[model samples]
Target: MLHIKNITYRVAGRTLLEETSLHIPVGHKIGLIGRNGTGKSTLLKLITGEIHPEGGSIRLQNGAKLGVLPQEAPSGPESLLETVLDADIERKNLLNEAETAEDPQRIAEIYTRLADINSHTAESRAAKILTGLGFDFEAQQRPCSSYSGGWRTRVALAATLFAEPDLLLLDEPSNYLDLEATLWLENFLRNYPRTLVMVSHDRNLLNNVIETIVHLDQLKLVKYNGNYDFFEKTRAEKLALDAAMAKKQDTQRKHLQSFVDRFRAKASKARQAQSRVKMLEKMKPIASAMEEYSVNFSFPSPAPLSSPIVTMENCEVGYEATKPILKRLNLRLDMEDRIALLGPNGNGKSTFAKLLAGKLRAETGQFAKSGKLKIGFFGQHTLDDLHPEDTAYQHLVERMGNGREAVVRSKLGQFGFSKDKSDVAVKKLSGGEKARLIFCLLSIDAPHLLILDEPTNHLDVDAREALIQGLNEFEGAVILISHDPHLVALVADSLWLVSGGTVTTYDGDIDDYKKQVIDQARNGGSGNSPSAVSEEKQPNSGKARGNSKEARKARAEARALLAPKKKAVQKLEKQIQSLQQEIEKLEIKLADPTTYEKGADYQASVSTEIGRLKAEQEQTEENWLIALEELEELENS
Candidate 1:
């Protein structure tokens, strides 16, 4: 749907894109992946015609619709719903025109075009997208101004989704998404029925969404017809091959030059040598693309000692104690706690995190932080903590405490801030630069109680993965609140579900958390009882919000009709039993010396298969119970 030819763009005397040509064919869900400051955002602008390239052309075929998930909020005091629905202004205008047609023929014509215009019906579309993107009913009603910057970005996203453009351009669509929302979005784009292009630092999201990798480097584009993993493997091989080819060319050129120099002095061999020299001079050099070594970072090693990390009892926390966001919350952290704090917006995930960090106090509760809890809290608004006036170095030194000048500089270098940027004031740094600096500052101590509110915010994919790995390896308690489903899945072994102004503990599974959170919200807000996988609901479909008392009755009826069969439930129980037995047999075999083949392979393969079976069994059992409960509730009536 979009085509670019030799597009080159530059700003502030630095080239962003040069001789970059790409053809984005119709209906391809393309994920734009790259490091921060590598012009992923700039490329999106070029495609949308918001920013023009200095050279070449970006051509979009006629009748193609373009949509972009805007990061910057356009001037507005609208509610989240208002902001999203406003994107359909053109349709609203057309709808208005149709209402007042002057003649019968005109009325018929307007009626014919009415399908294309439905701004009045935006409330339904906005709700559907917002719910899919992780907003509950309470959040949907919130004014955009009241939301934090991250939540506001979600509002902007809802607006973008509402436009229903043929070419969807998403920048960090998963930044505010919970696991449920991320999966919903994945399923949406997977069946988007149009073209997709997004810039994300998320590996799983990119792998699941995009078919090709468009590598941007030194103002040139290299298209790899592969996913992120495929691109990485291919990229290494391609570079090695290029290096060898370049070396061979250099050797040939050197040999030709030496022969020319020596033979030039001999009358008999001069012509042949001269011919070789000319041929060498005329040959185009085989230039190798620049290869940069990936940077590595290390957090300080911990001293041997403590076990239990952070403990909370009867915690009633919020900005104030009497009016708590969460009440009667109890939690304990072992030495190796990989806890993910999961919930929707305004459900007090960050508030609870801050309370744990001792940054804020619970109004009416006791928090006994175990044994000099070396706390490292990653604020959701990581960039906001950075002072505009202070240099990145100054913040690092101030928050991270004094380190050797060389050591401090080295830490900064790992995050991509070089000699000059390392010293540049945090105020002057770009949003992404500010986020990178936060990583350098926050991990300075390797505190036992590491509280990360939203570490991945504003980070491109590579930096995000680096941060996730760094967190994963730390042998301390981690309390992280993030919307990145993949990150949560990778790091969390436990979950704290904050919902309905109450907190509950659950073992962490990214998919399970989503199902429970949505189930709770659906029950409370909509009185709807739709099964999780039952034809995939779009009740938030249509073009309106919902229901009266009687409508709820219909939803309750639909819920009952789809309840699971008793025979199927019995079969699932048997499958679960068989799987458990098999897992036990594998464990016993792996433990014995003779039965195991290839220590690592046997252990890894068996463990992987066992984990998958266990997960499937658990899900089947949960779905069965929910279905049974619905049936019982229905039959009683």
Candidate 2:
């Protein structure tokens, strides 16, 4: 167990977290969530002991261990496996010492120490976890330098999981993972024996992975017992209630002040007025000080289309002329197709999209575009479509050639481009700002076919949801190439699964598509290991629990089979109770039916009702037996 007691944190002379106290119980899977710049990462660093808090203590039990996924990596082309194993060099050293203890007495002491250290067994478990996390056979030998920044972080993540510490701290862990890897991490975190805490923006991941959410707000910490969805609903209600209370308090405060002002000079009424004033002064101010600033974004609509938006025939594309990323691909895009290109990073998704958008010519085939197909492409990096030389204002103006410059400037302003920032060169923009600008550009005219490449790359979960909403509402066609599976699932109508210099089309949910792909990978097919594609173990794709359709249908069928049986059994039990009551009444009257007034008539009526009940019960019992048999048969089958 670890306790973060009365902590204060300051950065750049500004208080970040003030007098924050949190108790992390042993074996809890906690999630640290908050808006950007709210110190989620900073708090993680504090717990990891990377930085000392400005005040208070992070207390851990004696001999307790802590692990964190390093926010940044050391310079290296280190092999991925070697890098992961380095987290426990001390344990490795202990193993080495135990291996060579020479004197008999020393060896005995070494054996005991080794036995104690054996409980941690980080190295062995790390290897197993790395394997489960989708580390390919070669990952053990691959140098860390050969991997991308995301994969390098994955290497660090795998090592952290391997470290087998008492506490696991992850910050925005889903940032670089593909769906498959994220799913794996979710399952592992759920099953992890150690305490768990992480910061993430992924809604589904947060909902399923953690039991509690802690938020940092206005230099104060607030904790919620439920997941992100619960937090949102409860927080909204709390804020509304707070606002109402604050309004009432304001009204009372004004009334007290007005009375004091009107009567301060009146000798008879001065004491009563002053007493009211004191009550006003003593009243606690309400939550009127909380900010209402919301994150807002909107993109321009594109022009209408005529017909035959885009076409591709025998298209061949590749970075190298002969080494084709994709070859002999036949594809068609009409006014209604919303296509998502699916593949690993090295595959030809970007290359194929570029060909369709007319940014590049197909190396060995022909393609055509009919109608007024104005392509709005959001590339992987904002810099790809942005010009460093032009300001945000000028960029929009230049792109919208005939449009009035004033009108263009106002549109840019709508996207949070204003003041000196409107004049700043595009090169200096932040990732999210750049993404917004790209979105704005793409929105103009509602192009018939929108070709987006990693449109969600720099977007936060909230902004990504906005983009998805806009796309869903567009009525226009889309061809997007992205590695972010959440975006793919949200916007993609169908998948063009490309791999190993070939392409196959699949029609289904992104979740199902990924399941088949992972199953293929697990069975040793063309799909690269999820670990090799991105960092962080995949979150639960929700497929590993079982095939979705099969599980759903099985549950439904079970209920269907059991329903009639259950109804029949209930009817039989009610009839049995009624029959017992009637039999007792008849037995009581049997000895003196004539003595009681109208006793014979009452007995006949009761017998008739009881006979009908018994017949109906027999019929229901027969049906119940048949239904139960069928239910059992279905369950067995």
Candidate 3:
């Protein structure tokens, strides 16, 4: 067991934790959660002894070993497999000593230590971890310097997991993982036989792996004995009860004050008034919970489009004058299409999304789209393109040429930027803030199609939920490439498998894909033959396979069931568009200088009308999401 008693930590004169005590039992899986700046990472650092507390003690077993994933990847010349194996310090030291030991006794002692540390299986264990994290046999043998920063972080995570310490601390372990790898990691952590503490924003991971939640609020730690979902519900109830109790206290205080005010001037009630004053002084104050800003914005509805928004016929997509990563692709996207591209890392999911978004040219075959098609593409490096010197307001103003400043500010506010936050330079913004700004820019001028590559990379849980809501309400085709299973499962109506230099529609859902990955890993990672897997498991095989009359009839029936849902989604989209237009018109009126120059009553009326219009718009968007979700469920089913 680990015991933290009366510990306090301060940074730059700001107190993060004040005299907090926590006891984590042995082998407990705990999730540390809070807002982005609430010192979740700092707590992990304190546990790892990277930093020290200002007061109190953190106690653990005498011989306890800790394994922590480094925030930055270690620089070295070691190969990926070698880097992981090197995490076993005892094994490494023993081997080193045995190489130079002159005495037989010393050699025997070194060998004994090596066996105790299970050094014989270290290489194979490292290799399995690397493979599970999307590294192939060839890539695992390559030098660590050959990989990118994101891949390097994954390598560090692999090493940490392979270390197998008595205590493990992981901070956002799934940040750089693909879906298949994330699923594998989830299974690995579930069976981890040690005290584990992880900080993550992935809801699926928290729900599946954690048994307790440690919520850091107001410089204190509050423990909840449940998973993430249970914590959410319990926290909501607690907050509600606190609010009610505070209201009751306020009511009693007001009544006492009224009595004191009425009789304090009279000699007869002077003693009673003095007593009431003492009672008021003795009352404990109830602090209100901090208010968190929420993001509530929707993508502007795209222009009308008919069926077949985009089409590809025997298309080959790759870099210019190079071999294509995906080939012989035949796909069509309609206005109602919601497809998620699934595959291992470097297996061409992003290549396919880029091809659909027109970011890449087809090297062979024909790729065509409607003449009115407009695409909104969001790549992983989109944040890097942001100008550090520019403010969020300036970026929006530049995109909306000649637009009014008030309207731009209003749009920023909807994306969770306050008036002051809108003026700050982009460089000063956090990663989650930057991601929200990118989403704001992407949706400013809505397109008929959206192609997103790892859209949730830096977003927190709140922002991710907002993105899911927006995508559900979006009235356009979407081709999403993401590792977030929660978001994919909620929004994707179809799955497209991109592997082995080809692209085809997958006939199963995300759960089925996860099961296949786990099975493959357990079987030593050999079941990646896409064609064979699709032929054996896919209910509706691709066009390359011959179709029977029964298959044709089944396809027709599925289309027939989907047609009504599509119409319903279209109807909701039109309603949302109409409401949004009304809200924008009201906002424009409120922004006018002349309107404010009128009487105070007139300005007040304008503000009230704008608020009412915004409320209506919010409700309409909710309706839109419901319609879209129902449609997705029907299609996926």
User: How close is every model to the real structure, measured as TM-score?
Assistant: 0.74, 0.72, 0.83
Worst window of 10 by summed lDDT in candidate 2 = 529-538
**Candidate 2 residue spans exceeding 4 A from truth:** 74-78, 98-100, 104-135, 257-269, 288-291, 354-360, 383-434, 441-458, 481-486, 514-637
* CA-only RMSD, every prediction: 17.5, 21.4, 6.7
lDDT of 2 by residue, 251-305 (tens): 9888889999999899999999989978987998876635533334443334556
**C-alpha lDDT of candidate 2 relative to the true structure:** 0.69
The deviation in Å at residue 431 for candidate 3 is 1.0
lDDT by residue (210-251, candidate 3, tens digit) is 999999888888999999999989988888888898899999
* Backbone Cα, N, C clashes tallied per candidate: 9, 29, 0
The per-model lDDT (C-alpha) reads 0.71, 0.69, 0.84
Number of the top candidate by TM-score? 3
Across residues 319-415, which tens digit of lDDT does each residue of candidate 1 receive?
A: 7424777888887777656778766656778788887778788677777766666776668666776788988787777775776778778788877
The Cα error of candidate 1 at residue 458, in Å, is 2.3
Sort the predicted structures by lDDT, highest score first.
3, 1, 2
TM-score of 3: 0.83
